[model samples]
Target: MRIIILNNFFSGTAYYCFKFREYRLFWIAAFFSNIGMWSLVYGRLWLMRTLTESEIFLGLVLTANLTPILFFSLFGGILSDKHNRLTILRITRLFFAIFTLITGILIHLDLIEPIYVIALSIITGTLLAIDIPARSAMIARIIPKEHLPNGIILYSIIFGGSAIIGPLIFAPIVSVLSIEYLFYLIGFCYFFTVLILLKMNLRLHISKLEKKISYSRSLIEGFGYIKTQKNILYIIILGVIVGLFSSSFEILLPVFTDEVFLGDSRVYSTILLLLGSGGLVGTVILSISGNHFNKLSVLIFSSICLGLLFVIFSRITNLNIALMIVPFIGLVNVWKGTINTTVIQTLVEENFRGRTMSLQQWSWGSAALGGLFTGFFAESFSSPFTLLISGILIIFFSISIGILLLSLFSKIK
Candidate 1:
């Protein structure tokens, strides 16, 4: 009776992965942990904007967080494949808790600076290079193959829900206590994640699929799969484009709330809340539909939509219209991600899944480079102009490279 109720509550395949005890608990823990992490991130952005009042510093913080992943995630993926994923996850989360608490202490002492914040982001990024792949690979270990899509979709909802809930939760706390408390709260969340990770029992090992190979060989093998699989390569490339250009929208958000909307942190929080709400809705709809979509075609169409939305949002002068448009932007973004991630998860073999996902993350991390460009252009010109040009680039890439890749993909199949 309870099983039936749970299934109905989650809706459709969303509950398929939840039938597993490990996934159910992991889902809950990941949700709250992400909320804490994202709230900390939002708080950091607010703090950076307070300190520097420069778009560059805002983008720099993101760059520091992502750049390490771009360079180091492959090694992390290899480690995930070779080591115990749960152990890696637990260790990283523990360090994250410690580091965040220390940062909070610094801030509480009024000793925190922009450089310190950037340094902490760099450390977190390095940890994520390992943590993300191990964490993602663990999902495959715990869930059955037939229900991977359900796991992926439901897992994504954690993030979508967190994105909304995080800032909303942060606003009141930071407003009442201070930014340091937000960091302190984030530290507690990571500690909780570490605790939950320790309780997970994953004796299953996919690493046995590959014999003891040299580190270089393993790295080459992962890259080899991507090189040979032209379609997957196409998807990764397209993701790079999306990450690079669409990212400017976020990089400019603090600027938008300040200069464009003429408001403060509350306004910034409201925009994040709307964006996250749209993402949550989009993920839920996908989950209910059983991820039944033409993966390739929908991916392309969503890319075009994202590019168009970025252009529209940047050009519009009306605050109300812009606010209305932000949600749509969030919707398209999550849909593209859900389809892309599910397709990759389905196609890649278990052994290569960690590496492939790490690469996918690396492409997404190009947002750092995007942020750099965004900050540069916004500082040199105007935020609107920066975003307008970025939108045009996304459209150009989607139409040009996207079409060429699709043509090749169809012919090969």
Candidate 2:
């Protein structure tokens, strides 16, 4: 039974993309690194509480970690276009280890301060801002174009799966050992990522014209490309809408279980488990057969379904009924995300791929900001009502974008 399971795992439906050595190593390297990164997020937030019990400082810690992406991702995008992406990944990831190690050392020495932690967060966040575009740009270079969608779905699986998997694994480590040791473990994970990246032999082409362009011009060109490419622009806008409404609702989950359903912590955990299970099912199905569908049509229909699910989910007064609805929420949401990313990669030019992707890097920050606003509105209008508005807005905008896309393609024809 174990042997059969291992065999199937090694030769799964998405194994076609995994056949490439570059992507395989890249995936393996990124998996540990991303897991560490996600797991350490809790450590950082926890460490902040140790430094200062003030909720304001804790909030600042998170803001410092996320806000840099808003401004620096553009610069990272330019760096991706102008330089060797593999090299950028190497440098940024190396620093990821370095800073992480530095934080651990400070904590161990009893020299850590809230301000110091916040400063390190800014540095780490800035490195991430630079890394994201280069890392994304590297995807096309490593994988075969024919299997790109499957490759992308697999990549998304690692990332999204890590968010749930990482904390669960590392949260226990932080509890069992010291939080400082958790940092050391996370530091080693990143160092291991650097080691794996060094071993991967990847050859990427760099254009001479890309080398000679000014930063100002390269930035301008990225915007110009997206502006002229209506599809890319519309797709990015849709991504923003999804991020703001659907992606950020995890913040409201506790409120849902506590206030709306009058349940306890176990119920909150149950909601999370259901959501994660749904996500797993959705990704598995998509990884196996998502490539057969028309990308744009799948994207539009998924977005609409997701919006409706959000509406239905918000209105659910019964826990069992909400549990059933939650998995479908996870399904169409993943469908929308997977198809959105695949569509962008398929349509974007190599030089613009990094920049085009960088502009979409608002996912984390936008979700954070959207959650705050949603919370504020929920306080006034109730969580259910605010979420209902979110759903309506998403549906309205998804259809609007779909219509714009149809019109644009019609004119192109």
TM-score winner: 1
Model 2, position 284, has a per-residue lDDT of 77
Which parts of model 2 have CA positions greater than 4 angstroms off?
1-13, 40-64, 98-121, 174-185, 205-209, 254-273, 316-323, 363-365, 378-386, 410-413
Which residue pairs does candidate 2 place in steric collision?
A: none
Among the numbered candidates, top lDDT falls to: 1
What are the per-residue Cα lDDT tens digits for candidate 2 across 1-413? 99788667645556567778889989988888877786566567667755664444544565677667878899998998888787888888889888888888998899999999889988998998999888877888887777776788888777557655654554455556666777887788888998899987645535334577899999999999999988788888878777777643564565677677887544654565566557667777778774566778878888888888888888889999998998777777777887788888888987788898888776554554565566567666777887788888889988988888767767877
Kindly list the per-residue Cα lDDT of model 1 for residues 159-197, writing each as its tens digit: 789989876876687677888888888899988887787
Q: What would the TM-score be for candidate 1 when compared with the true structure?
A: 0.95
> How many clashes would you count in candidate 2?
0
Among all windows of ten consecutive residues in candidate 2, which has the lowest summed lDDT? 201-210
Tell me how far the alpha carbon of residue 226 in candidate 2 is from the true structure, in angstroms, after superposition: 1.6
The TM-scores of all predictions, comma-separated, are 0.95, 0.81
How much lDDT does each candidate structure score? 0.83, 0.76
Error of 1 at 43 (Å): 1.9
